[model samples]
Target: GRHQANDPRPSHFEYNGVRFGQDNLNVFAGLCAVDTPEHVEQMMKVLRDNGQVCTRMGAYKPRTNPYAFQGHGKDCLPYVFELAGKYGIKVIAMEITHESHMAEIFEALHQTGDPTGVMLQIGTRNTQNFELLKIVGRQQRFPVLLKRGFGITLDESLNAAEYLASEGNRKVVFGLRGMKTNMGDPHRNMVDFAHVPVVKRLTRMPVCIDPSHSVGTRAAGPDGMLDISHVVAQGVIAGANMVLVDFHPAPATALVDGPQALTLPELPYFLEDVAIAREAY
Candidate 1:
């Protein structure tokens, strides 16, 4: 069943001062995965200079290829937190696959004296991981960013979100990360930003759009419009509360999703374009 359009459940989800929908467009930009200390520092510094505070830091990645560069994990937490703290990044959206990863993250937070906050991310691959969903929901220390399942129906994805909210953690941001279907063609995943408003209407939860994963490439289209920029504008205009995209000091050498990651130098223009799109909304 769909959540009632007028459901009274609080839809005001916030983390480190960025209130979804209530505040200005929230953008979470950073590397798809933590790379070198220099790269992280560079990206964070750029973000700080540009007046952005929230970012995506993938400490643990869930990949289809078992041998893929599966993130640096807990080992990179200290420096990541240190850079985050140093650059005034208040919150980081990070993923946790296994339940134990939560403890590991908490430990890292403890070691860093909680300088920066982490919003637990449940990637699309784990949207239906019932046990993990329950574990994440029970914890109140962090908000949850639940990406729609890459291979499931929109209704099924929303139900999966219920798995988290039912556990009593209602501060959830439903992310539209496109889908795994081939109907999208030329692109890696189907661009699903059209559902941004539908999600808002059907549930009392904020909506975020991951343009990076949706298009899975930073290439420009026939119209000379970069695919990422176009998709981002579509979501923002559709009332998306947050934007999650990827950036790297050097995308060419990025360990994962290199082709999809934007270069650091291109960030300001992207931000400007996104701001314009937000204004259009």
Candidate 2:
């Protein structure tokens, strides 16, 4: 928490008139400890409360602390999707670390009509995970959210995308969260800002920015919400095809990454600015 530095001031607010970014964004409302029928119910509640039509449902969790919940794993997936239908929330479940779990991932999709399509997110731990990538790509039921590694170079990051793309999975979506760990600074991870445009130029697929992880703090500390507006706008201008912003109905009460979440009122207003920023690109 003691690692904040004087970054540039947030840019002026600008609302562009673009119809939409290259790909319309789907805010990922994650459920980490969803292990029972009750957790499923809570998922729907959050979705409804936020007016969120869908989410990335995590039945099996990977947490840094072992004391954390590993979730009900595959046991609660169907029930999760079942509740989603009951609440009209499209469900996206994560696969277990083993190929054996692929069965359950597809099963959930099949049972749910797959909604907007299940997403195979390659988390930081899975950046260089080729075996997993090949396996996820093998499934045709969903798209992917390929998060860049903490310190992975831009080329290496794009190359991971290339591997997925080569498998003919055009639905691959690239995510950025910047690299700052090796620098021994607490300035939050600076997303590979240039990746926004670089990936767009090298591949025909879509790209989006994950700014919550970029600056690390969700609150607009000294600068205010304009800080978010400026960073996202510049990201778009720099060639980010789309944005993957994380927003919650309430930030302080969030179970995960609460500090980084933008308030509900903040999202649309921010998107208005993002839509405008994207128009400039």
Give the number of the best model, judged by lDDT. 1
- Per-residue C-alpha lDDT of model 2 across residues 116-178, encoded as one tens digit per residue: 345556776677788877777776556666877776677787777767766765566677767
Whole-model lDDT values for every prediction:
0.88, 0.60
Question: Which candidate has the highest TM-score of all?
Answer: 1
Candidate 2 regions with alpha-carbon error over 4 angstroms: 1-54, 83-98, 112-116, 184-187, 226-229, 249-253
Any residue pairs clashing in model 1, and if so which? none
Q: Model 1 off-target regions past 4 Å?
A: 22-24
The C-alpha TM-scores of every prediction are 0.96, 0.72
Residue-by-residue lDDT tens digits, candidate 1, 194-266:
9998998888878999999989887898999889999999999998988999999988999888888988888
